[model samples]
Target: MPNPPDYSWSVQAQQPVDYQVSMVQGLLDPSNSSLARACGADGVRKVRCLVVVDDVVDELYGDRFRDYFGAWNIEAAWQPAPGDETAKTLEQAVAITEAMSAMGILRRTEKVIAIGGGVVMDVVGLAASLYRRGIPYVRIPTTLIGQVDAGVGVKTGVNHGHHKNRLGSYCAPTTTLIDTEFLRTVEPRHINNGMAEIIKMALVKDADLFELLEIAMPVVDAGMMADRNPLSIEIIARAIAGMLSELEPNLWESVLERSVDYGHTFSPSLELRADPPLLHGEAVGVDMAICVALAHNRGMLSKEDTDRALRLMCAAGLPVTDAVFTAELVSEALRDAVKHRDGMQRIPLTTGIGSVRFVNDLTDDEIERGLDFVSQWAAEHREETA
Candidate 1:
């Protein structure tokens, strides 16, 4: 048949992704000029930029950013977005693009600046990815979760149809400017929320980072950002590095059997289903707790390590269990995860602190027994945590 007349042609290539995850303090300080340089603001030229700020972040330190642009002779158009879980929606992303259109945003020469928490970062990055078929954006993650976890990675997303992060893209930013100083004013509970990610990294990789977190817990009572001490800074840097190391090799998430998926296997459903909507990190903590119990039950993780992990989570101010984390919910979440993980559970279970082993044969009976163990342990030790 002469190869069916050979009508098909194929093009295979790799899209190179390069983005800097820089740790710099005083990002908004006019004297710093780091952010100005990232936005391509030359000293003599008049540059235009679109700055999207979370409403709460705007109220907290918006004026400083305003002055920063003024000092650098850059024209900034400010767009305020709601700073809540619900803000991660398609509508919000489109609204930011609308603002970009209103400002006549320059495609290649200019960049969009997302200066807020994770939701604002995700929504704005999604807008940038869609606008003009992809534009450069800079992230200045104010919250701890943003700096250590969300800001360091190259993914943009928004929620649809009650699914957490159901719509998203692997759109890397131009650069992510992380300044721990912004976390100084973050709420206590939010600080704990960020700690959950750090703990996840500790559980999955880098035992040294885990010990440092344990040590720093006492001094930095308001979470890692309360005190800019050496211990706190070291812990933050280690956590960021650890997450990036895992992400760099798998930026597109081409590999589903990822250790970084330790707490995330069932977190999407838990995050979306919890009444009042648990924070991303909170949901992850609950899932990690469940997985820890499962690992212990399988003899993959020691009871001592399981107790220590749960205790540390409690000490770090993360919720280890919740009403919505029922066995039925766990079953549903695991089913979804199997589909998400490309037909295998590939669930990451911590065999010991800072190590992980994936298992595909986890059954419903096993999960139920694990949950019962976790419930009993949680009940017995809730009073003794920390």
Candidate 2:
């Protein structure tokens, strides 16, 4: 009788994840039917959708939004929320969830569409993931960062306890619909902020993308990234493709030596600690600059490559250094990263543009040297920035 229940049962299964990133322009134009189709609009049946919109996006496109849905016979319940970094919080996610419930959204039939930057998408995705355990959601990423980076991935998150993305989930949206037209209204600096993520992908996985960025630097400098420009579309599309390629193989991130992590190692702390918190891309730019310095000191990156990398970032209106970024901060951030990456500092360093090498054995002295290099470079380029 005592040994009767000694046998143990084990369950093993593989959960398949499938999602798409659609590059649809004029998504909000009254004549466009892409969004209508995504929201389940058919010729005869009317569609009811609960849309979580950024306050800024709503303010800018509210009328057109109504017109777009009206033309497609979609009854949209507009739920506008703050779409900045501060809105990346658990409370905001809860608010979005509350909005979903009030709409009486059907779990499988109805989909929540998030219209804004990365923050709005994250909040909405998290809410959708938790409502009744799971529900499909759509992302119409307006910001550059959202379209190219955050919106392409399956991760949804909210900031907690003064930490960036401290509480999160890996829940892919039903689909992410990208429309560069929304960027026409985005501030230049905000657009540049998104370029940081694009640049990160270029520096680690695609040299050709880096070249396109360089070629387009002047256009970017002038803040003239019009959707009509094929070059601009190619740039964003390439970055998005490269990011997805890297991510698809390791969607769960079970392998921690991620090339996509090049600039993220220290950015979170600096990002959260800034008095006026840096844009996510700004913080990442600073982090990438540091990694460039680290790579240079390790003799992994050529001086020519280093200069090109930093100069491109500068031309794109990104900060390569922050006063708070120091050797001490580097050490602390790497330590935290080590813990996060399962006891190994899987720090991704650029061997050259479009290539990376992970180093687990980084010493404090090495980190100090990296910081020194950054200090020197920043000082050398001080006049350019001024």
Candidate 3:
């Protein structure tokens, strides 16, 4: 009785005239019965689905999805929070696999549905990839990060300790359902956490996205307030649209080592060192900021461009400092990220506004210098906040 949910938005930014992007949109909680009937499934038959979810969503929207699927006589089997912490373990995946085996789920009969944020999506997507050698799945992203980046991208896998995204595959979802309504129930920290990726997409691909985000900051801040702000949702949806538009082709690429990884190398390394793990987007936010600073140090980025990029992150409350960034940890993580890229490969690094390059000529000392500069900035910020 929540008045269902209204879908509306205004387009403030102009769509690209020369560019074309393909996407399929479905309601977050539409009648699945019609879909089943259209597919020639029994009107009373139960379609098997494995839902992977987290605690927050499970408590709030679980019943809604349950009822929605129940309408279609679909059997929704959920693998709720894997008690053992950490996104990189094989234990939870093994458990889910065992559950699927016990259910006697056939490859064609069962479909994996990911119903949470990045962690849940990664786990579910990986399970779908391994189960019966490949079963289709749907993504119901519950977080801004998941909706915009993780939930849409085909790279799915768990972590391997200090290293990030150490295990994964290129298994794109059959479809993704994104409802801005979901963002209403999310915490501010989570929203801020996802902004990192938005900022990344802006920096790496579209300058217009960065500019539009700047214009929408007032609305974003208001959404962070006790009350909801409409514009924030619009901005997030717009950002997702822009990202999807830019990244759709790369969505199914076998090697994501280049196109999708911009500041990720530095960011993931920082995550490993933080006492409390940094959100994926937060790490990327910090890394993007540091990359700007490093680009300036290397004489690749002008001071004006650096300031502009950093200020935009600050306006959105995205982390732009390495206050928690440590030299030793950064070195190790960068090494790991570099290794993840597979040898002295040409890694993408930005030089100017909207300009990026894949250069293998960077020395370790240059990276250390970049980390040092951001470390100093982080220290200054801490003092100011304190």
Every model's TM-score = 0.97, 0.97, 0.82
Judged by lDDT against the true structure, how good is candidate 3?
0.67
What overall lDDT goes with each candidate model? 0.88, 0.87, 0.67
Q: How far in Å is the alpha carbon of 148 misplaced in model 2?
A: 0.6
State, as a TM-score between 0 and 1, how close model 2 is to the true structure.
0.97
lDDT of 2 by residue, 196-230 (tens): 99999999999999999989888673235646577
lDDT of 1 by residue, 1-386 (tens): 36665488899999999889888977877889899999898667989999999999999999998988988989999998997998899999999999999999988898899999989888988999999999999999999999888888888899888678889988899999988888888988788888999999999998898888877776665544745678888888999999999999999999888898889988899899898678999999888888999999989888888888888888888887888888898899889889888999999999899999999999989888888887888889877443
Among residues 3 or more apart in sequence or in different chains, the pairs in candidate 2 whose N, CA or C atoms overlap within 3 Å are: none
- Candidate 3, superposed: residue stretches over 4 Å from native: 1-45, 82-87, 221-234, 241-257, 376-386
Error of 2 at 352 (Å): 1.0
Model 2 lDDT, full chain set: 0.87
- Angstrom error at residue 250, model 3: 4.4
